[model samples]
Target: MACFHPLTMMLTLVLAARLAAAVPFKNESYPLTTVPGERPWNPIEPLQQRLAYINATAMAVSWNTYTSLPDEEAVVYFGTDAWELDRTAPSRQSTFETSRTFSHHAILSGLEPGTEYHYRVAHTNCFGCSTIPTYSFTTALPAGDCTPYAVAIVADMGLMGPDGLTNSTGKGAGGALLDNETNTIQSMVQSLDAYEHIVHIGDLAYADYFLKASTQGFYGADNVLTNATSIVENYERLNEAWYDQITPLTSQRPYMVAVGNHESNCNNGGVKDKVNNISYTAQICMPGQTNFTAYAEHWNMPGRPGPSQNFWYSYDVGMVHYVVLSFETDLGEGLYGPDEVGGTGKQMSGPRGKTGEQIEWLRQDLAKVDRKKTPWVLAFGHRPWYVGIADAVCEPCRLAFEGILYENNVDLVLTGHDHVYSRSVPMFNHTADPAGYDNPRAPTYITNGLGGHYDGLDVLDSPLPANVAHGIDGVYGWSRLTFANATHMRHEFVAARNSSVLDEFWLVRAREEGTCVDGEEGHTGKDNGKGHGKGGKKDKRDVLARLDE
Candidate 1:
């Protein structure tokens, strides 16, 4: 028999203990609250109803049904009045083989901008369809409209209840668990009037985490079953629970999202195999787990034609242009590539070749923005380029898209992944702009991933980076961005528990004439530096007329 050294034996035991501690065990006894009246009266009853913006004149409505319906029967009826739904639009149905239910979607088009419309989703073939209650949503303001609007930003939010809290403490990053949701959800519900839409950067639900724990026997010996049938039912319940939890908000506003590492693989741990010594895992991955199947099928974003369309897209809301990018894949070599998870080579989304397609698309999109019409450009993704945690910082993502964003003068960039909140001064290449928030030349970066989730908070690096303006890890909260006008925007980080303002700042920029100075053809006048009236007020009508050329 081989004898091991005492020191080696001691180290081996310590490593094992840490590994066991890192694995989260399921609390089977924790009570999960059922959504009021969520039990379907029929197999075709819709749940998890959500809305997304397609354009100024259109909005997309989607919901989940236990059973698939005929394409012609998946329809929405709508009108401006709640009593009479005078319009109808046919819908399309889709589902992943790994999913137990079908998703139905329909677009309400020819809508008036900024007008509230009441609608109801139903299957015409079903009996007593009129009993479905009516829901209402407002269309986005037309581009070039300088009306003020606010948007809510959240990330890393998991399913409400015990699943979202730390198992040992039975609490979140904030304090005691108040109800099913973290402070973020309660806060948003209380201040519904504060924002018109919600931008969920990524990690919508912890479904994959649940699946991982169940397959690894963390849920209990009886929950160790990982068959295809078990996996499908596992995700179905988790997805429905999360979507139902947020229906109060998503049903009323456009719930925009981007892809995160949690959305990449089934196990939510990373890839399972190895390529040339680099490890990747596909051990428990099922059909719908990879390729963002569930996320893509559930959402119908207005994405341009490309393999990464659902992952990367842009939309204009009032005076701000919002661009969503994927930090999980299509980002060429280095960490955050398809073959890695959270920068660790231990797990991955497998070998997805980099085509540089996303970056190229970003370039074209940013190049086409006419700043004279929409003065503020905000880009958001799942991972952060500037954060307090070193490991959480994605240098590869910064290398890929920072130059283009800076060149185009993107006003702000939002990201989540660190589970802590940190804001950086307007910076490029790690250097803070001397002008700061006052007409800065570079984008101001913020990591607002503190929307409470199962993993709890991430510890920030001591001696925080010089560029970080504000950093917090103890509290669970979300940020609100108010596009006050063409020249002024305000951002506030609000505490989830009490709805207190934790941090606030104003980003001010002068509306320069010929702001189309980014080399887009049309106006050739130089910046007079006197603000809007320097050449004459160029309103929406003037911008629209020029675009008609």
Candidate 2:
């Protein structure tokens, strides 16, 4: 990181380090005016990394103005090209809900798909304050069957640039924080990205603050039992340090994301004790609002969960049907979910019924998927029902939907909860389908929980799933899912250790047509669907077990 004032270049466009280093003087003549600094303007929330939305006829921009700036209008300049600071889309910042952060949304209509637009933000008037740069995002691709070269898959990126906790172990040149899940995200702050679209598997920044009484402002953890309170105050002081890590990468790419268990109130004993994080829901300028307001405001993600009836939505992205489901609660957990457990000393609930809803939605969603319209059906959630890791407390819970998906011929399953990467064989009933080798068998499964988390790496309690050719661990990395034409897709593990491909392989959907991920059989003599990956080879493990028999 170096600094040199250009004797040749003028100050019209100052590129100052985001740190507190004296901002390179642009001009004393045009002192930054408007947006009174009396109340902190601060870094905007739900920071956009790489926005990869579709040609939404109407796209909105929104935010919060903190409690002190009681009166102001939320404005956005629009149009496809930069420079011409014309087109105005204005919405008054309405003072709503409780708390100090004033939420806002401004939906701009008539935006063309696959096109870029630039805009600026202001409260009092669009002047003087550090000018919100000319940011542009490409809307989601049109709804049809087409193919893009590559898509980056990253999980557990909770809006921080660093991994928070520091530890040194075995990352070749010694371990740096990036060594274990570095924020080398290819989104935000760039001239478009090589990846047309990206998917953030889960666990976004633990946003729970206004001007969180910390040096940086906010912490990047989930807002579960803690709400957005200061219990994680120490985490807040880390904003400056973390933001310095990822924004550069994510801002450059068009990103699609999945929710992690940490984003909402997973630990609260009572229902009301739980809060819907505005940080996890809502897009700026949209009329809707929520608990994780910061997330909804800044990221402007669509179809979030909760009483808002927003979570678990799907869209089309060039030859693929991108389905995002919420496993944090939508799927279910006896102690933490579904039926609303006991309210006393211990809270316990059966599987959340959203599974059934999503199951039905999946049926309808997939039913609507005319192969001609969107050829590849790719579904993802935060929790990976089948992983290599084992829990000492209890056997890991397998997803109830694996059976449904297998029966439906899903092309791929992607997840992020486990903080390490693990890829399973083309399995149906927890065993590899030798049929996986031919044209028309079972769907393929890819696990890339390695995008980076402080939880450390995960080791398999079981053996490799049949033909799992490649795997890596003890290092941090992100997954890249590359689509090669219609019938072929490749998964590569990009290690932050050195940005190298730790593990890479191809999944030929046209090659394995009838395969399923139903899990292995149990003593009950029925397909219990528990994640039991095959019993060795040769004389034992049955191919596609249940189906083979």
Candidate 3:
């Protein structure tokens, strides 16, 4: 037996405690200024300003205001130049049952494709007008235009410190650390010009885990729900903080999003009736806690004729046709259906039934794609069929939409649910394509869920599936998709801490009128046939150099 000194033991214990200490949830809100005025009544300045692509000639700008303004006052003023604002579009204000603030959205239309426009949101009543600082965003390029562009892909990203560092040490119930977000956000900001827009597939803020703490346990520990007001306020504040954190990027670029499990429900553990064990009730949940109340209220995605436009929609940017799907509900067959998982206990039955609506819509959407115009077709959603963790694999989702996607010859599938970065060979039905990425028969899958979140990071299981070409864990990062030309596209997984390229791959396919171009000849895919290893040496150097400049 070995005896340890008292001082040594005490020091070791203190260090262990520090490592395991849960960082308290910060309730800091965006430092928004009130409208400039000496009048007794002044509306709160707009916060969480964001942009979404409505069409080639239109874009939707949304923001949050704590004080209610008259309907006539909500509007957006815009023009080609920041000083000469000439056009105005009325905005609609909306709020949820438990919301403390109102959300306003205004659509700016009749704009030229690929043209930059400066805009400001404000209350423009007859008395006076108060406006936020002007921001600019360039409209999307015309459809069918094979212009070279890149889009930053992120998922499961959460709030970071003001200086772009990890703010929380508490690993939530899922065991994911709330670190690496600073790296991810800083990298994106540094290379803002590198991508046209950002596609955040799912798990935006993780506000659902508002009660996560070391003492209370990560998940919704039943005891913490006693104070309903506190729960609601914290949840809302966390969301506000997260949006404020991303405003630097989102305000400047179009931030597209999809629903993830975190967005599905608030404190998902519901209380079940012990007698029958057949029904459950959300005792402490607010109106925004159940279903996707917060998500739908926050974002005004492109219009689609259905219960909600945010659930499913399609848009085109440059040479890529992008489709956003819903894994939480409306999938033909899955754990998440109407009133199943995060639902409000109300069925979404209408022209399109609950179960098969999204799937049917997807089939129609994919069938309408014209290969010649937009040569690359990419679909993004929250849950993933293939991931590093075996138990996290969404078999139901795979079964629901795999056949249609494979049949349509989709080019790429992007998802983020398992909290890791992974890329697969272009294959189908659990088999790797022998031809590799060069004109493969099936769509390649990239699971980019490693965007920083409260859960530290998922542990990868040994003996990865056969189809996975590369998979990485314990790194906070995002993926970048560069559509170089009609027949060539490149995917790179970038480490958030240093903007280093952890993995690189190019999808090569011959279009009807063009052959695949060897963009980076030697660095076609992962190095030495292994995943997450450093590759694309010259390209990585160029990216770092650009960041320095």
Best candidate, TM-score: 1
Q: For model 2, where is the 10-residue window of minimal lDDT? A: 519-528
lDDT at residue 399 of model 3 (Cα atoms): 77
Tell me each candidate's TM-score.
0.81, 0.67, 0.79
User: Model 1 over residues 1-549: C-alpha lDDT tens digits?
Assistant: 012345534543543354333222222111112232234545676677889998877999998787888988878888776667889988888898687678898989988766677788777775453233567777776667665567899998766654444432311223335443335765676766667789999988777666444433333344434576666666656766677667767777888998777776566664222212332244566777676677878888887633455688999876789999887777754446633554553335533334676777789999998888889999998889898887677777888778888999999999998889998999998889999999999999999888876555787888788889888887889999877567778888988878788898889888778543432222222223323211113333343342233
Better of 2 and 3 by lDDT: 3
Clashing residue pairs, backbone N/CA/C < 3 A, model 1: 270-348, 271-280, 271-281, 271-347, 271-348, 272-280, 272-281, 272-282, 273-280, 273-281
Maximum-lDDT candidate? 1
Off by over 4 Å in 3: 1-43, 126-131, 162-168, 171-181, 214-225, 270-282, 333-353, 514-549
Candidate 2: tens digits of C-alpha lDDT, residues 421-535: 7776666666776766344456666767665433345655556444554456666677766655456666778765456677776677562332211111111111112222111
When 1 and 2 are scored with lDDT, the better candidate is 1
What is the C-alpha local distance difference test score of candidate 3? Answer: 0.68
Q: Residue 20 of candidate 2: its Cα lDDT?
A: 20
> Each candidate: what lDDT?
0.70, 0.46, 0.68
For model 1, state the Cα shift of residue 54 in Å: 0.5
Tens-digit lDDT string for candidate 3 (1-549): 012345534543543344332222221122223211111133455677899999878999998877777766777888776666789888888888777678898899997766677787766542222323567787876666655667899998875542112543443234333443345766787777777799999888876555543123433333344367876776676676677667767788999998776665555444333333333334466666666777878888896733567878989875678999876667675345433444433322221246677887888888998777677889898888876666776766787778888898888999997878878888688777787899988889999887876654676667776678788888889998877677778899998777788998889977775422332232322222222222345334544454343
